[model samples]
Target: MFSMFRPPTLNIFSRSSRQKDSPKTDIIPHLTPNRFPKLIIASASKTKTEFSQQQKQSHLSSVKKATANNVENNKGPKADIPTSRSISTFPKKQLSSSPPIPRSTDVQPFKGLAKSPSTGTFNSVARIDNSSNTNPSVRVNFHLKYQTSYGQSIRIVGSHPDLGGWNLRHALDMHWTNNDVWTATIHLPSSNVVEYKYVLVSYDSKGALSWQSGSNAVLAVGEEDTALDVHDSWGNGPGASVSSEGGVATTREFKLQAWAQDMRSYKEVARSAAWEASRKKDELAAARAQIARLKMELGLGSKERTALEERVAALERANLLLRAELAQGKLVLKRTLEEAIKLLSQDALSVEEGE
Candidate 1:
C-alpha cells in the first residue's frame, strides 16, 4: 500500500529537479509526501500560464505590423500598447483586452489650394475681380434738335472708338423724339477727351451725307463726373464763327433758303394768283371808262373802237402767260424737295449696314 503513494512523491521530485536544472525555469519548492494533491494543481497552473504568454505574443506581433503599414501609407500615428501594465496580474486577459485607442496626427494640408497632377505643383483658387462690380462708370447724354424730311435721319460720328472712330460708315443713329428733337446716350471711359460731329444721312443715295458746318464738338470728361448731358442744334457749334464765310456755311445757307421756299411756295402761288386777278379787273374797268369817254368826244369812230378792242385782247394774253409761269415754278420746287429727301435717306442706310 505505501508503494502506491510513493510513486506520487517520486514524480514531484523529478519535476522539481528538472525545474532547478533549466536556466529559464523558476525553482519550484520540493514536494513532501503529504502535498501530493498541491503538486498536481501547480503543474496545471504552469501549463495555463504558458498558453496565455503565447497568445499575448501573437497579438503584439499583429499590432506592430498594423502600425508599420499605417506609417508607410501616411495614414498618421497609431495608439501604443501599455507595456507598463503588469502581465502577471491578468496574463490571459491581455490577449482578449479592448483594442488600443487611436491617436490624431499633426500633419495638415494647405487651404484654398489644389495639387496639379501633370505639373506636380500646388495652385491657388480662382477669384473674380470685384473692382469692376463696385466702381461706377461714366455716362454721357446727347440731345439735339434737327428737322429731317422723309427718308432722312440724323447720325453722330466721332474720333473715339466708342463713337465709331470718325468713320461715317459706322456712325451712331439718333432716336427721333419728335419732329425736330433727337436723343441718344453713350458710355465712355473716365477722364477722356472725345471729338464728335453730327451729320444728315440719306437712305437712298451713296456718298450723299451733309456734315455739320463747323469744327468737331470736343468734350473733356472728368474722373469725378459720372453723368453729363449735352444739348445742341444741327449746323450750330461754338466754332461756327470760323465757318461763317466758308463753302460749308454757304451751302448750309442755301439749304435753309430752300427749306423756306418749300414751306411758303403754296402761299406765294396763291398770293400771285390773287394779285393777277385784281390787276386784270382794274385794267378792264379803266379800258371801259376810256372807251366811253372817247366815243362821247369823237362822236363814234370805227378806227378808235377797233383800237380799244385790240388793247383789251393784248391785256388778256399777258395775264394768261403770268399764270402759266407761276404753275411751272410750283412744280419745280416740289421736285427739288423730293430729290433732297432721297439723298439724305441713302446716307442713313449705308451707315447702318456698315456698322
Candidate 2:
C-alpha cells in the first residue's frame, strides 16, 4: 500500500519531451504533482528576467536625468542682463518743435517787359502800313467787270513783269468772282504809275489770240499804301464778241463725245460679263456629266465585287468537297489492302495443312 501511493520521480534534465518543445515549456496538457516544480521553476525564471529588465530601465533613466542636469548647468551666466519690462520703463529723447515754412501767394509783375506806350506814340504806330514786305512793291487788286464763257477766260497785261509785261505768254489769268467780276491780284512798283489792260483768252482747238483795241488803264501806287483795289472794265476787242458762242459750242461737243465713250465702255463690260457667265455654265455642265459618269462606274464596281465574292465562295466549297472525297477514297483503299493480305495468308495456311 505504501508503494502504490508513492508518486513517480521527475528528471529535471530529461531531454525527450523538453527537446521536442524547448529547453523551457510555457504550456502543458495536464498539471500534476510532478509538474509543480517545472511550473515554479518557469515562473521563477520569468520573475528574474522581469526584475533584471526593470533594473536596467531604472539605470538608463538615472543616466538620462544626469546628462540632462549637466547640460542645464553648463548654460551661460545671466548677470547684468536687462529684462523686457525694465527696458520698456526707461526714458527716451523727445522730438523738437518746428515752425512752418513761409510762402508768398501774391501775383507778381513781369520784370523784363516794357510799360505801355502813350496815346501819341500809339497813334503814330497805328498809322503805319502793317502789311510786311521785303521789297519796295505794293500789292494791287485788278478787278474787271465781265461775264466769261466756259472755255473763255480774262487775263491782265501790263508794263510790269507781274502784269505779264505786255507778253501774251506771261499774262496772268484772272479768276471770275460773283456779280460778273474778274479779279486778279498783282504786285506793282511803289511811288509810280503803271499801265495795265485786259485781254480775252479762248481755250479752243483753233487757239486764237485777241488783244484789247483801247488805251491801257493806269495804276498809281504810293509809298504809304500797302495794298490797293483798282477796278476796271474789259476793253473793246475783236475776240470779245465771239467768245460766248464759240465756248458754248465747244463745251457741248466735248460733253457729247465723253457720253459716247461711256456708252461704248458699258457695252464692252456687258459683253464680257455675258462671256464669263457662259463659260461658267459650260464648266458646271461638264462637272455634272463627269460626276454622273463616276457614279455609274462606282455602281458597276460594287456589282463586280459582289459577284466575285460569291464565285470565290462557290470555289471554296468545291475545294472542300474534293478534299473530303479524296480522304474517303484513301480509307477504302486501306481496308481493301488489309483484306487482300488476310486472304493470301489463309491460302498459304490451307496449302501447308494439305501437305
Candidate 3:
C-alpha cells in the first residue's frame, strides 16, 4: 500500500553504468512522504487530456535521454565483427530464382513408371492437338515423376533414337511444369511399346548424365485406350509380376496391371465427354418445353386479368347505388319524425285549452 503511494524511481545513467554502480541505491532525488498527497492532488486537478499529454511528454523525454546516454557511451569503436578476409569465408547463399520445390512427402510417388517412349507417336494425320483427337485409341501420354534440384534437369533415354537410343547425349529432356513433377508427352507415329529410363542431366560445363537407379520402365503404347496419362517415380524400378495375367503376366502382369490404370483414365475421359453432351441436349429440350408452357400461361393470365377487372368495376357500381338508396331513406325518415312531433305538440295544446 505504501509503495502504491510512492512515485517511481528513475535512473539517470546508462544501463552499463547501472551494473557498475551500487545495486540498490539510485542517483534519483527522494520525494518526502508529505509531498506525495500534494502530487496526487495536483495530478487529480489536471484535466484528463492534460494528464495524458504529460504522460506522453514524460515518456518521450525519458526515451530521448536514454538514447543520448547510449550514444555518449558507444562513442568508442565497436568490437570487430569480422576482419575483411574472414568476411569472405562465410559466403552468403543466393536466393534461388526458380520457384520453390514441392515437399517430397506431400505427394505419393507415381506408383508405376509406364514404359512409354520418352516421346509419343502420332498415327494417322496426327490430330492430338485437334479439339478432339481423330483417333482416341492411338493416344498415349507419359508422366515422369521426379524431384529435380537447382541447375539440374530430367530427360529420358530409351532404345529409340528419338529417346537418344540409350545414349545419354541423345536423351530427350523432360519439361518441368513447376509441379515438381516433370512430364514428357510423345506424339510420334510409332505404335510399339518401349523401355525408357529417366536421366538426370547437370547443366554444368561438364554436362554429366546420371541414369536412374534400377531397371528400365516398359510401356505398351496405344493399347487399351488411345489416350493415357501415366506416372513414373525415380528409382522405383519396374514392379513387373507374373501370376496376375494367368501367370502369363507373371513377368508381364505387373506392367499390365499398371497399364490397366491408364486404360480406365482414357475411358473415363471419353465417357465424361459423352455424358456432358447428352446432359446439355436434355437441358435444351427441357428449356424449350418450359418456354412453351410459360407462353400458354401468359395468354391465359391476360384473359383472367380482364375478367377480374370487370368484376371489380361491377361491384363498385352496386356499392355506390346502395349508398344513394340509404341516404334517401334517411331523409324521408327525418321529415316524417319532424311532422309527427309538430302534430303531437298541437294536440297537447288543444287539450290544455279545453281543460
Candidate 4:
C-alpha cells in the first residue's frame, strides 16, 4: 500500500543518458587553464572604468552651469570690473610694503603754511622806496641836533600841514636819541614846498617857549624828489640849498625882526626903571620939604627936630640908591643893544655866504 502512495518520478535526463551510452559521441573543444579567469577580470575592470568616466563628465557639466548662472546675475558695468592685465601690473610687494597715499583734501601747500619773518631778524628787510598807490605823498626825514637844559624839550612847527602849520598845539615832539640830538620823520606832498623851524619848549610851562631866532627853513619839493632829509642845529634853519637872492632877503628880514623885538624889550625895561626912579625922586622931595618946614617952626622941640633929621637922612639914602640903580640899568641896556646888533650882523653875513 505505501509503495502505491509514493509520487512517480519522470526521467528528464533519460535521453541525454541514452545518447551518452550510444557509440556515436559529440566532439568538445578544450579551453586553456588560465583564459577563464583572465576574461572575468577584464570584464570587471572595464565596468569600473566606465563608471568613473561618467562621474567626471557629470561634475564638469555642473560646474559650467554654475558659472553661467553667476555671469547672468552680475549687473555692474564692464569698465568697473578689474581685468587680469590691470591686476598683474600692480606689484603685490609694493602694495603691502608702504602706507597708502593721502587724498588732496588731507594735504596743504607750503605757501599757505609759511610764516612771516619776525622783526629785527635777518630776514626782515626795509623797502628801498616808500611811494605806493595807497600813499601818494613823499617821506621827509627831519634830523635836528640840540643841547637842552633840564625841564626842556625840542619841538618842530612849520608851514606845511605835516609840520603842524605853526600851531604849537599840533607841533610834533622830537625824539632825543642822545643828550643833544633830536630827530623826526614827516610826510609831505611830493610837489609842495615846506617851511619849518625848531622851537624850545619848557616841559613845565607852555608859555615859556623860545622859537628859533631866524627865518623858517624853506624846502621846495619837486616831482622827482620822493624822499628828502633835512639836517639842522638848534636855532639855525635847515642846511640845504636855496636860491641866493631869496636866502639873502629872508636873512635880512629875520635880522630886522629880531632887532626890532630886542629894541622893544629894552625900551620897556628902560621906561619901567625911569618911571620908578622918578616916583622915588618925587617922594624924596616931599620928605625934604616937610623936614625944612619942621626946622622953620620955632616951637618944635629938640626931640622932634632930631626925629625929622633922621627921617630926612633915610630919604636921602633911598634917593642915592635909586640913582645908582638907574645909571646901572642904562649901561646894561646900552651894552645889550650893542651885543645884539653885533651878533645879528654876524648872522646876516654868514647867511649871505651860505646862500
Candidate 5:
C-alpha cells in the first residue's frame, strides 16, 4: 500500500490509470506556419490593386470636367457670329449701273401723183344729096375735149396717107384739143348703101385703141340703107323704080330688101310646092314600071291580083303569130318586173326594221 501511495514515478513501465488512459503523441515534422504569411500577402496585394483602380477613375473624371469647361469658354466668340439672326444686318448692291435711253430718229413723208391728158375724138353723122341719090356719100365730124393737171399740151394724130391726090400727107400733129373741134370727110366708093363705124385712139399711149375687147358701145355699125338700088335683082338700071300693085313707088333695091321680104317668101313657097308635085308624079310612074317588070320576071300575067291576095293572107297569118309571141314575151316581162318590185319592197322593209 505504501508503494501504491507512492507516486508512480518508479519506472517507465507502469503508470497511473489516468496517465495510461491519456493519448500518446509523436512529434510532427516541421510545421509550416509561413504558409499563412504567404496567404496574407496575397490578400493584401489584391486590396492594393482595387484601391489603385478606384483612384485612377477619380483622376480621369476630374480631367474630363476641366476639358469641358475649356471648350465652353472657346465657343463664346464664334457664337456671336451670324447664326441667321444677323443676315439683315449686312449691306446690299445688286442692280445695274447704267443711265436711261433716248427716243428713235426715223420718220418719212408721203407724196401724191397727177394724171396726163388724152388726145382723141370720135364722130356720129351722116347725110345724102339729091343729085347724089343714084351715087351717095357721107360726112362725119369729131369734137375732142382734153386737159392735163400738169398742163401738158396734146395734138390730133391721124393715120391716113392719100389726102390731096398728089400729096403723101400722113399724121397731122395739130393741137386740136384746145381748138376742141375737128372734121373728117370720107368719100366712099359706090355701094348698095352700106353701113360703117369710126375708130378712135389715144395718140400718146401705144397699143391703146379705144375699142377694147367686147366693148360694143365705143364703135358700132347699123343696117345697110335700103333706099339705093345697089343690087338690081330684076336687072334694072340703078336709077329705076319698081311699082307695086298697091300703087306705091319703090326705088330699086337689093334682092333681099326688107320691104319685099314677104313677097320673096311667098314665091319660094310656091316653087317648093310645084317641085313636090312633080316629084310625086315621077315616083308614081316609077312604081308602075317596077310592077310591070316584076310581073314579067315571075312569069305571071298582068292579072296577078290573085297572087297578091294570097301573099296578103300569108302576111296576115305571120302577123298573128308575131302578135302571140310578143304577148308571151310581154307576160314574162311583166312577171319579172313584179318579182323585182316585190324583192325591192322586202329589202326596204328589212332596212326599216333594222333602223
Candidate 6:
C-alpha cells in the first residue's frame, strides 16, 4: 500500500542532480569544428539567398519604374501632319503658307443728287450716308460735279406698240465718288413715277465678271401710270409723232422699245460721225506723212546737187590746168626743134666749106 501510493517528490533537485552528473557532462556543446563550420556555412548560404532575392526585387522595381515612365512619355501630343484637304482648301494660303481667307458681307450703294431740266445744271446737291463699311482702297469724297455740254439735243419722241403713241425713257449718269460711293444723276423728261435699279460692274480676282447690286432701282416717277394710250401721230396718223408724253416707258412685248429706237438712232449718228472723224484723221496723217517724205526727198536732191556742182567745178578746173600744161609743152617742143634745126644747118654748111 505504501509503495503503490508513492508521494509526489520535488523534482527541482532532480534536474540539478542530472545537470551535475558526469561533471555536468562537460557537454562542450558537441559543437565539433566541422559541424560549427557547416552550420556557419549553412547560415551564410541562407543569408546570401535572402540578399540575392532582395537584389532581384530591387532590379524588378527599377524595371517597373522605367516602364511606367515610358508609358507616361508616350501619351504626349502627336506631331501635326498636313493633310491634302488642308492644302487644297486654300490654294493661295497653301502657296504662301498663310491662313484662310475671310468672307465679305454685302454692301449697299448710296443715293445721290437731284437735277432739273436745264442742261449741264448742278442745281441740287447730293447727299450720301456715311454709315457703311468703306472699301479699303477707295477714299470717299463728295463734290458738285456737272456733266459736260453735249452737242446733241434731248428731243421728245413718241411710239406705239398697239397703234402709236408716246413712250418715253431716260438714261442716268452714274459714276464713282471720291468716297467710293456711286452717284447717279438721272435725266428724264418731266414725269411722275420712275422705277430704276442699280447695277454693279465688278470682277473677281480671276477677272471673272460679276454683279453685286440690283439691275433696277426703286419706283421713281408717277406720271405714266395714268397717262397711257395708243392715239397720236404714232397711232397711224398723218405725220410721224415727234413728241413723247412720258419721259420713261416700258413694255413686256416691246421692252425698252422707245429706248432701243432712240439708242439706235443715236448709235447710227455716232457711228457716222466717228467714221467721218476717223477718215479725216487718217487723211491728215497721210498728208503729214507725204509732206515729210517730200521734204526728205527735196533735202536729198539738194545735197546731191551740191555734190554734183562740186564735182563739175573740180572737173572744169582740172581740164583748164591740163590744157594750159599741154599748150606750154607744145611751145617748148617747137622752140627746141627750131634750135636743133639751126644747129644742123650750121654744121652742114661748115662741113661743106671744109670739104
Candidate number that wins on lDDT, 4 or 5: 4
Tens-digit lDDT string for candidate 5 (267-315): 4555555555456546555655765677778767545856755655665
lDDT of 3: 0.51
Q: What are the per-residue Cα lDDT tens digits for candidate 3 across 37-154?
A: 6656676656667756866665555444443444347563222233324434522232233445879887895778545433322121222332333433344344566777788877
User: Which run of 10 residues does model 2 get worst, by summed lDDT?
Assistant: 119-128
| Collision count for each candidate, in order | 11, 0, 22, 0, 0, 21
Ranked by lDDT, top first: 4, 1, 3, 2, 5, 6
Best by TM-score: 4
lDDT of 4 by residue, 1-355 (tens): 3333321112313433445553221121111233535534443545555645744554454444443334346542222223333443534343233457889989886576434332211111121223442335656666677777888877778775446678876566666676567766666664344567888887656433788876666555444455555666665743442222112322323334544565567667776887788999999888888777767876588898888888878888988887887887787577667655665676687689779
Considering every candidate listed, which one attains the maximal lDDT?
A: 4
lDDT per residue, candidate 2, 1-355, as tens digits? 3333322235323433554554222122233356756755554545555645754555455444443343347552222323334444422221113333546745576688443332111111112222553447656666678886788776777776656578766666677779988876666555444556777887442233566555455444544456656555565321221112113312222332343444445455555555555565565556556555765677547776567556556655655555555555555445444534553464476467658
Candidate 6 lDDT tens digits, 1-355: 3333322123323444456544312223222344545544444545555645754554455444443344347663322324423422423332343454655544456668656544322221122212342311111111122221222211121121110122222222234345333343322231112222222222121121222221111121222232222111111212212222353433321323333344445445555555555565565556556556765677657775566557556655655555555555555445445534554565476468658
Q: Answer with 2 or 3, whichever has the higher TM-score.
A: 3
Question: Per-residue alpha-carbon lDDT of model 1 for 1-355, expressed as tens digits?
Answer: 3332223446556766666654321222324346757655554545555645744664555445544454447644443434424322424333443655655655565588544322201111121222443434456667788887888766778875556588766556666776578766666564344568888887554233688865556555444555656676775644221112112322223333344454466457655766776687688778778878888888767886788878878876776776566566556456555544654464466457558
Q: Estimate each model's TM-score.
A: 0.29, 0.28, 0.29, 0.30, 0.17, 0.18
Candidate 6 Cα lDDT to native:
0.35
Worst ten in a row by lDDT for model 5 = 213-222
TM-score of 4: 0.30
Better of 3 and 6 by lDDT: 3
- Pitting candidate 4 against candidate 6, the one with the higher lDDT is 4
How many angstroms is residue 169 displaced in model 3 relative to the true structure, after the best TM-score fit?
2.0
Candidate 1 lDDT for residue 252? 28
Clash-forming residue pairs, model 4:
none
